[model samples]
Target: MTEPNGTTPSSDDDQIRKILETLLADDEDITARAVARLHPSIKAASSITRSESRSRLLAEYQQRQADYRRWRRRVAKRSGADTATSLADKDVRIAELEATVQLLTASHLAMLRAIGELGGFSKWAKFYEHHREARDRLAGFGAIPTAPVSSMPAEQGGKKIKR
Candidate 1:
């Protein structure tokens, strides 16, 4: 079967993969929904998300990020690079760190939100329960921080205040 562009299904898939790779390389949002919006012709974005291609790409990107984090940590340890040499260097480094933190936080919150949307709190809780060991490993690696929920300062409605 061929797509509307007279390309075979595999070719169409290749096109989609290329677009996805470009989006990832640019550090742009490439959620299935976002991709569908950006390219209206690809109508099966949700199905694509469940496909092996999407999973592979996501895994690859995650591995790259993990490698980057390990490299940065190693460099920091070797050079004690946490201290900036000048005020301008400090400002630039602070901005970069802030952006990284924000990106990681946003990615995590988005995943949590997706889980909630899929099956609410019960599913979210179940997910954590199922992944407890992996989560602990991540925390141990310092990829994620372990903090007590009660220790967080709450706002008026039980929501944690963002610092």
Candidate 2:
């Protein structure tokens, strides 16, 4: 099969490949419009180069990415075994911190249940919600709001504190 212009597909592909190599050597962008501008004889330059040049660009980009990963691995090795040890230590520290947070959450829930049994949960919830809202409002003013007196223990509870 041949184009109306009498050029065969394989021949057109060969031409496109050669043009792409020239573009690469010149360090210029390998685009259909650029190819057409350089060699107008190749009719429908985009369709001709779509299969040829796209794979070439994709391979180049993949090579660059692989080079970057290899460079990072080399740098990490140069930093020595201490960096690996510190990374392992950080993982352990993170696990310990997560466990501590779980324990604190359980304790907090137990305390809330005890307060609910004493029928003081409603009042506590109201005060807690109001405190959060006040804190958020004060934050916009760049001020740190103090805890309300109602949030204190029964022994320390007193009249409501104004902001």
Candidate 3:
């Protein structure tokens, strides 16, 4: 096309303009159609190149899919093992806590019973005094002496005792 200055556009400009117009068109699917039509050699080479590229991309995609599958399996196995280990550890910890609770409960009940036995402050003081006196007496006397009580089998209908 001639410019307003009366200058004619070059062949290169016309070719570039046509390619640009083709690009701006709605059908972007036509890759180098104009060039392929101008040069038959390039048309064959472009087709071969496109075919090789498509095959290479497909192979890479398949490899990546396989790798992803392996990775997913490994992740799932690790997560499952972690979950199982956590559950086992939790069970052990819970058992340990239950045992501790039982011990604490028994100790608490014993303390409550001991406190209940003391009816009042005076009774508590007397109880302490009685135990203290008995302990001191025992200490002074050394080991406690056992008393023997005799029961005659002839006095009652009873089983015979083996001495």
The global Cα lDDT (0 to 1) of model 3 is 0.49
- State model 1's lDDT: 0.61
Model 2 lDDT per residue over 28-119, tens place: 66567666666546645455446555456535644655666676687677666777877799999999997886676567656666666566
**Distance from true location, Cα of 128 in model 1, Å:** 45
Global fold similarity of model 1 (TM-score): 0.33
What would the per-residue lDDT of candidate 3 be over residues 32-64, giving only the tens digit for each residue?
344345432333424323545433433444465
Off by over 4 Å in 1: 3-7, 65-163
- How would you order the candidates by lDDT, starting with the best? 2, 1, 3
lDDT of every model, 2 decimals = 0.61, 0.61, 0.49
Choose the strongest candidate by TM-score: 2
lDDT of 1 by residue, 114-148 (tens): 54445454654566688998767645545442332
Clashing pairs in 1: none
My TM-score estimates for the predictions, one after another, are 0.33, 0.35, 0.26
Error of model 2, residue 17, in angstroms: 35
Cα displacement (angstroms), candidate 3, residue 97, comes to 1.0
